[model samples]
Target chain A: MPKPMLKRSVQQTQTNNVLSVTGNQKQNNQNQQMNKMKIDKLLRQKRSKEYMDALHKLDVGGHVHNQNKVDEITNAIKREFPEVEISGILLGYVSICYLGKPYEVHTLDIASGIIEHYKSGETLPNGMEKARGIALHGGYEFIEVYVDCCRAVSSNGTVSVISI
Target chain B: MSDRVISQANLSYIERNLSAIHGEIQALENDVDAVNNNVKVVYDQVGVLANEFHEFVYEQKKANRLGQAEIKLVQIRQELEKKYGHYDIVRRTTTGILQADDLGIVKKTTISNATEELMISTPNYWLAPCLVALSAWISDQPELAEKALREGIKRNDEKTSLFFAIICMRANRKSACLKWAQRYLANQDEENLDRKAIIVIDAYANGLMGADTEGVISREMTKWLEELAEKPGFVEQQTTQWTEAINLKREPIENSGYTYLPKYSNTWPVLEDILEGANLHANILAYLMDIFEQESSSAPIKAQLDKILTSLVTDFDDEELPLRKKEKFEQFVVEFCGDEDRARQSMAIEETAFETHKDFTQLLTDAAMKPESSHASVATQKFAIALSKEWILNAYNDVIAQNRMKIPTEIEINVDTFNSKTTDGQNEAQLVNEFTQLVTKEKEAALAKNVLTGFDKFLLIGGAIIAVLGVGMIFGNPLGGFIAVIAGIGMVIKHFNKKKQLVINEENIKKNYEQKLENGLQIIRAILAEVVDFRIEFAEKDDESAKVVDFLEQITPDQYVKNLSTSNRRIKM
Candidate 1:
């Protein structure tokens, strides 16, 4: 009888050990699933916020950028060719030729200010310089050169430069 | 060891996939940022281009206006020259006659010899009437002049009639003068007269009579004088004689005074011719006095003549005098009083005459008020008034200039008011109104465009970013990211295309401006051509015409060359 009872006790202990191991594995799987879901949600939320911020920045930047370009063109035109009366603002990319080279100038008010020249090139400082150059050359070229300084402010408020 | 190995592999694979997704999202965000930046740049460029176009258009308008103004100025100058250039005629006549040795139709040894020979050789039937007419006219014989005129007319000899008319006019036989003048004018054909003969006839008829005729008479006289003055050969001699005459100097006679006496010798062949006349010497003296009285510088001579005329007027009774003499004397008084002061006095007479002889006064008033009559009278009167005014104004101007006086307070104030009224206040008010309308429209357009561009740029960037993030959220959304990139590129292309179209529109406007300028120049050229023709005709002299032609030539070449040069420059540019 003593021999049989010892065997039974050993079997019971083995079963209890198996059950505890299974419970521990299940708890660990649930915790891993929950952590994965939490991480995915946080990442999506961060990405959306970044996109929203970028979009807002872009909108504000566009307005500021346009305004800055106008100011730069106006200043450049005023400085280079002071005689050209500024009349009003207009919009578009205005390319002006200065000193035989073409440069693009941006302006918000075209009706108010006098544009010296038109050409295709990189950004220029003033419309008047191109006009002056054309005048000096007896209007020989297709473009006018303005001798003016322009103020440009970046949209991000990071850069401000004067072109002359 | 086996379980640990399985977990590590799975974790590593998931981490690699997540990193790839995150990389894609970053790439998409960068693409959006680039698009946004590009849109901003394009917007700025468009603004500048628009401004340049506006300036170009304005300059073109200004140039057109200036060209038009210059053309108008040229036209006005030509018109003024045409209207006022004829005043140089009177100075020509005095000089031409002063230098003539023989005032005969044909060259002769002497004017008197020619006259006597012509009178003697002519047939008695023809000669007798001409002699009587000439004698009567020279002696201011009123009844004999009428009889002589009638006899000449019955014979129907135009040449003799013309001679009688000229003589009668010179003698101041106003009635006989008018009758013969009317008869001669009625018989004459203008086409038959050469310019020189016409000039001589005009000078004799108009200049000697001092008729105060206007229109064709005055115009022709002025034209003749202008032509004569411009002749280098005649100008100096004529001007010198005029100055001498005006200064009351004894002018040199080309022939001795008696040598030319034969012109009147035939008419006085018998003692009866001189003695049987009605105070022939007194008539000659009276005629001379009449001519001198109107133009005399000596006040006493004018006063004496006035007294004589006044006495004659008071002494003569209208019914008691012979009909012919009464008619002749009345015509003389009417003509004499037709001068400037007389005209003013006659206005009062006109009003009184209207009351007593209403029918006659109405007829006379109607004649005076007629446009043709006013045209004839007003032209001369205005010219005289203008001459007097110009003289006074010039003298006043000289005084003002010499004194260096400040402008009068009244004038200064008026000028200030005029400037402010016409220029500052008026123009500013107009400009403000126009500008307000323009700005409101333009600003609205600009704002709309700006917002649209901003929204488009934002959408392009935002969509790309969102697509990239979505792809990362899903396992691998490559298709979505690819679609976003395509849309962004399309948006950029669309924006660029829009900008290009705007540039084209601006170019079209510039082209239109150039076309308008060309059209305006053509109109100006046409106007200038008309002015040139008018100036040439108006100048009416060989030398003046030549000078005008030269001036026109100079202007034409310069204008044509300027136009060609500008066109060539435009092509080159």
Candidate 2:
């Protein structure tokens, strides 16, 4: 319950960092630690606009394209789960996990699918601690992902759904 | 053995060695005491620093949102103006026509020439033709007025009818006002009334429509209720919405009020929510009463008509809704920049209230409460509340029941390194005992780890025995036995000193733990007392719900019309 997961196994196949030998682990092993620091330094330099473009090819929040997609999926989710008065759909990437292993980044749809699974007797998504009746912040509910990046209300009909 | 000789200097030397070990123990005890004493102060400083960090983040977010939202506004306005320029002109011209009368600078012919120019310039614009009809009607040109009115109505009948209705009311023509209003209402689907229709309803409910004395509009309202009631789950949906709306009126309790409960109690989230929920009963009543108590607008008829017309002009046309929705969403920077969750939730509610048509209940409620936008007068608020009292009460009841079920039997208070619990503050003695037990278990575990082993104790005792044997042999073998005596004496002194240090270490552990337990007990007592106060306050607030009920009971729609009706103006006629 502490970690939100993806419904699709394909989504959880640990995204390989081809450039780094160390997989972001900070451990007691000196060799791994040194290699991790070296790899992280390189990655930090690779955060230029061109690198970001090459890595994030799908463009999770590409304004018009993603906005339209968010609108489409938001409507679908609302129709499918009318009881959940979603405020709006957000299209962005979130980090998720399978079992206990983390996949540093995944499309928001992976989390969306997990929520759909939550509706059908599967485990509730990890970040949604304030879902449904448990919600109390202003009589509105929220999902707060306290873990690093994976931090994953309608009014009396005043609010709506989020898709991405 | 009977008379082993020992020197006075040797005895004084032993006294000095034992005294040094006692002094060393005292130093370690003092160090532990100092650390224990500073724990609480250090913790308080950390808490303060955390609050300061929170303040920094909040301010930073606010500043960022401001900049981002400003940029969004500039972009949105540029688009809104470019695309909706034709619609914009109609709204601006409507206000100008009314303002021109007071200015008396523009002559009748000049006004005619301008309206004709606008019509030619903005072809196929609906309200432009409506403005021409209004100008013709005012100028007493019957043929031109009829022709323009037909054209305006043909373009948008609902808005044109509403336009003429407000104009007729301002001119004090009661029969024409009534007929035009009924015509506007006639075209509306009860469930899908135009967004602008709310303004008309607000005016009617406030008794500004002097002709509705015979209950013609009242019958239409009753018909709306009948139709809404016939729809399945309609009442339930209203209940949920009304509950949320009423809950929204509750002001949050100050965080510092129950300062330590949030820090100590795991149940604080639920506890906090229940307190607010309990307060809702009083808060919502006061909100409604405040509405009822505010003074009604007494603006002269013409001036009031001008405000209504201005609002109508500014209201978006059906064609502009898609773009307007985007504009409205971009209006808030935090939402526009990245806090899409808040933006989405807010827009959902806002869209419900102002963007689209809704049932009579929601329309009237918005008209009553969100008066700046919905334009419901004070009298209309009273009328709407009295009309929707049943739904309001049911929703309030549902909310109360839901909160009651979440009440926990026992609250768990988690202070640092201590887990204290209580069913209520009455369990103070039990809580103190439990904390002491936990402290005892911790102290015992630590002392156990540092205690001298069996071999060290055997060496300490065994060394003194050997020292005595060597002293007995001192007289027997003068130099050789004396060397054995010195070696045995050194071993005994070394272990005895070590044992003394271990005793001091044990005492320090005991003092440190006992002091920590005392601090935890103090925190528990302070937090427990607040828990008691919280319940008492919750009860006092919960009892105030009856006041809202009693207040609502006194409200009647018929009584409101007397304060707001234009019948006084009509009687003089």
List runs of model 1 lying over 4 Å from the truth. Answer: A1-164, B1-152, B157-159, B166-434, B437-441, B453-573
DockQ of 2: 0.01
* Candidate 2 local Cα displacement, residue B569, angstroms: 9.3
lDDT of 1 by residue, B39-107 (tens): 999989998988898877766665554455455545544553354222112112212221242242323
How would you encode candidate 2's per-residue C-alpha lDDT over A107-161 as one tens digit per residue? 3343443222112112344444223222221222222222221111211221211
Candidate 2 has an lDDT of 0.63
Model 2 bad stretches (over 4 Å):
A1-164, B1-164, B298-359, B372-376, B414-420, B432-450, B461-490, B502-524, B561-573
Give the best candidate by DockQ.
Answer: 2
TM-score of chain B of 1: 0.23
Across B1-573, the per-residue lDDT of candidate 2 in tens digits comes to: 423445666777888988998899899889888987798789889899999999888767866776777787788788878887777877887778766754556667766777877888777777888888777766778798889989998988877887788877766666677778877887888888765666566666555676466666767777788888766556656776777677667667686377888888898998888888787777677678788788676353335555656667778877778878777776744555545557778888987765566778777667555656656677677778877776775566456545543555457889877876665578888888888898999999999887667877776667777777778887987776677677777777777877898899899999999888989899999988988887677657756765765676676665665233443332111
Clashes of each: 40, 15
